[model samples]
Target: KYSQMPRSVGGLNAAGEWYVLRSMIPGLKDKKVLDLGCGFGWHCRYAREQGAQFVVGVDISARMLERARATTHDTAIEYRQQAIEDIDFADGSFDVVISSLALHYVAAYEVVCRKVFRCLAAGGTFVLSVEHPVFTALAAQDWYYDEQGQRLHWPVDNYQQETLRQTRFLDTDVVKYHRTVATLLNTLMDAGFRITTIAEPQPTAEVIAAYPEMKDETRRPIFLLVAAVKPV
Candidate 1:
C-alpha cells in the first residue's frame, strides 16, 4: 500500500499526474485551506509553504496521521483524523478545499460535495482528482497483458453502472465506488458549484521518457480532475 511506502511529492506514483493537479491550484497565500483524505499531509505542508494562513488535513487513518504529524514541523498545519464523508465545518470556513485521488473510496460523494460547498467561502475553489470512470469501470481495474508480458489493452465494461467495486491493491482488497463521468459532473453542479475546469491530463514527454512504463498513460487517462467554484 502507498501508506506503507515512502511517498514523496516528487515520486512517479501516477505518471506525474500530481504535477498536473498541482499546477491547477491557485495561489494559497493567506488562505485557509482544507484537504480531504490528506494522507501523510503532503499537501498540508505544501499549503503552508505557499504561505497559507492555516491548513487543515483530514484523513480517516490514524497511522497516516501519525506519520504526517511526525514528519510535519509547520505550526500553521493541523492534522485531523476523520472520515471524508463525516467532515463537518462551519459555513465559509475555508478559502480552498482540495482532494486528491480520494473521492472514489467515498460511496456518497453527493453528500460530501454538499458539505464542501457549504464549508467553502463564496468564490472558493474546490479542486479534486479521482480515478477515471473508464479505468474504474473494469472489475479487475488492471491492464490486460499479452502472454509474452507485453501490454495489451485497457478493458472497460459496465461503465454506466454505479456500484461498489472490490479491487486488489498491494495484496489488499480495496473497495472503490464507481461513478460515470456525467454523474461526477452533475453531482458538483447539483451542489451549487460552477464548473471551472475539467481535465483528463496526459503525461508530459519528459515524464514519459523518464518512466517508459508511463507511456501507456498517454493512450488512456487513468485519472480525472475537476475544479469548481462556489458562486458569490
Candidate 2:
C-alpha cells in the first residue's frame, strides 16, 4: 500500500498542489519564476498557466521530472532534477520562488530557505505552502467506522509544541518535520524574507456539508499558505 501511495497520489500532483496553485495570488505575468521541489511538474504547469515568462522547476526525483517534462512542452518551462539543500542558482536570480508541499521533507529546511533567499531578486516574492502542523499532529492517531460511516475513534491530541516524527503510510514511512507557527515565522525571518501574508485554508464548505466526517468541532488548520518578500 505504501508503494502504491506514491503512484496513487499522482507523484506530487497531490491536493496540496491544488491548494498551492490557488494560494499563489496571481501576478505571475511575464515573471521569471522558480518552482522549487516541483515534483512531476504539476504545479509548474499551473505557474505557466498563470503567465510566467520563464519558469524553471527543480526536483530531485528523476522519474517524476521526466513525466513533468513530457507533460509540459512549453519552451518557457524548464524542469531539472536537483537537490533542494543545495541548489544550482546564482544570487538574485528569480523574481518569484515557490515551493508546494515539499519543504518539510528535508530536515535541513533552513538551508533551502537560505538558498531561496539567495536566489530571489530584491523585492521578489517567495510563496510557499506546507501541510499544516495540525495535520501532521493528527496523523496516524485512529479512525473507525461508526454506525454511519468512517470517523475518528480517538481525540486529536498531539499539537504539543512542534515535535517531528517519521509517519508511515501503511507500508512506506517518511519523516515529517512539524514546525510551530513560531518556528516557521522565525525561520523565514532569519532567512531574510519578510512575512507579507499568511493564510490557513479550510476545506471547501461543500465538502463539510456533504460529509459529516469532514466537519470540525473546533477549527483545525489542514493547510498553510505563506507569502514573503525579499526586501529591496
Candidate 3:
C-alpha cells in the first residue's frame, strides 16, 4: 500500500498535540520501547528522547521506514521493516508497547492482539491511540455543519453503522472497518490483556482555538485511548 498516511501517522499529530498525548505515558526512563506500526518513527524518536535505553520502530512500509531512518539515524532509534503480526523480538521483550493511529489497519484483530500480548513483559503496558469508533460510524456517511451545539458533535443518527470510502493522505481512496466501543473492549479481553482504562481524549482549549477540527471531536471523541496491562 503506497498510501501517504497523514503526517499524523509518523508525527502522531498534525497539530503537535502529541506532547499532550505523550503526557499520558506513565514513564519511559530506562525502559525498552517498541513503536509498532511506527510510520516515519516519530514516536520511536520521542521514546529515545524520553530516556528509553533503546527504541525500536517497526513498520510494514519500507519507504516510510527508510525516511524514518534517514531522519533519525543519530537519535539511537532503530527501524525495522516488519508486520505487527510478526514482530522479530522475543516473547516478553518490551517494557512499553504503543501504537498511534495504526491499530485500525489490522483487519484480523485477534491475530494482532495476541502478538501484542505475547510481546509485553509481565505488568507492561499497552497504550494506544486510535480513531473513536462512535464518531467514525456517525461520520461514515453523513456530513453536516455544527454551527450551534452544546457538545463538539451531535449524532445525526446514533443507530446506523455505515461503510465509508475516503482518501488517505496520499489522496488514494481507502476502506476502513468500524467496530463499536463494546467490540473493542471485548476484543482486548479476548486477547488476554486486562483492560485498565478507556478514554475519549478531549483536546485542550488552546488546541481547540487553534484547530477547529478538534472542536468537532472533543465532546464526541474522534479519537480514543486504550491502556491495558499484561498480567503476571
Candidate 4:
C-alpha cells in the first residue's frame, strides 16, 4: 500500500500554487478537462467533484500515476503517464486545460503554448502556474540567509537570461528553464490566447499564522498564475 505524502491546505504550495490555480478555474460543470503534470490526481479529483464530464490526468512519473490510481475511484477520470513536453491531444479536444508548476521544466514553453492553443476548443480555458521568474532567476533558488540563519533577502540574478538553470530539488539534481514575465504572457498572445487573468499569489493571514515559514513568501512572489482563453 503506497500512501501519499502529507500535504496541508496551508502548506507552501497550497498558499501559492493551489490557491491561485483554484481561483482561476472557471465553471467546470460537464466540461472536458485535461490536467498536465497532475501528480497524485488531486486536481483531477477536484474537477470531478465540480461535475466535470471527463478528466484526463497526465504526468511523467509512472509511480505517481500508480498512486493516483490507487487513490481515485472515479470512472470518469483517466490517468496517463506522459511528459508535459510530449503532450499531444486531439484538436479541440478539451474545454479546460490546466498545468501547475510544470512549464518551468520544459525547455520550449512556446511549443507547448502553440500545442495548447491548437488543441483547445474555441472559448476553451487554459490555466497554468509556474515558478515566478524572480524565483527562478537565481541558480541557487534560495533566499539569502545570514550566518545566524535568518533570511536576509531574496536575490534576483540574471533576470534577463532566459536559459536552462541547474538546481537541486528533492535531493535530486534537476534542470529547469527560466523565462521572463513578458515572454510568458507574450507567448500566450502569440499563440492566439486572450490573456484573462494574471496573479502573483499572496499567502493569506490564516495560512501565515498556521505555517510561519510561509511568512517569508510574502516578501517575494513564488509562483505566477495565468489564465487565458481561445477566442470563440
- Whose lDDT is greatest here? 1
**Residue pair clashes in candidate 4:** none
Q: Give residue 89's error in model 3 in angstroms.
A: 2.7
Residue 11 of candidate 2: its Cα lDDT?
Answer: 43
True-vs-predicted CA distance for residue 142, candidate 3, Å: 5.6
Task: Give residue 137's lDDT in candidate 1 (0 to 100).
Answer: 97
lDDT of each: 0.89, 0.74, 0.71, 0.87
Candidate 2: list runs displaced more than 4 Å: 1-23, 138-163, 206-219
TM-score of each: 0.94, 0.80, 0.81, 0.93
TM-score of 3: 0.81
- Local accuracy of candidate 3 as per-residue lDDT tens digits, 1-111: 333433443345544346555766769999988988898778888788788988888998898898888778655677889877677578988989988877666665667
Model 2: per-residue lDDT, tens digit, 27-142?
88888899888887766777788788889999988987887887788998988888878686999989999887788777777888898999999999888888777666655634
Question: Can you write out model 1's per-residue Cα lDDT over 1-232, one digit (the tens) per residue?
Answer: 6754324444424336767788778899999999999988888888888999999999999998998899899888988899999999999999999998899999989999999999999999999999999999987988889999876999889998899999987788899999999999999999999999999988778777766767899777899999999999
Q: How accurate is candidate 2 locally (lDDT)?
A: 0.74
Model 4: per-residue lDDT, tens digit, 152-175?
A: 999999999999999987567899
Clashes of each: 0, 0, 0, 0
Q: Cα miss at 221, model 3 (Å)?
A: 1.5
Residue 51 error, candidate 3, Å: 0.6
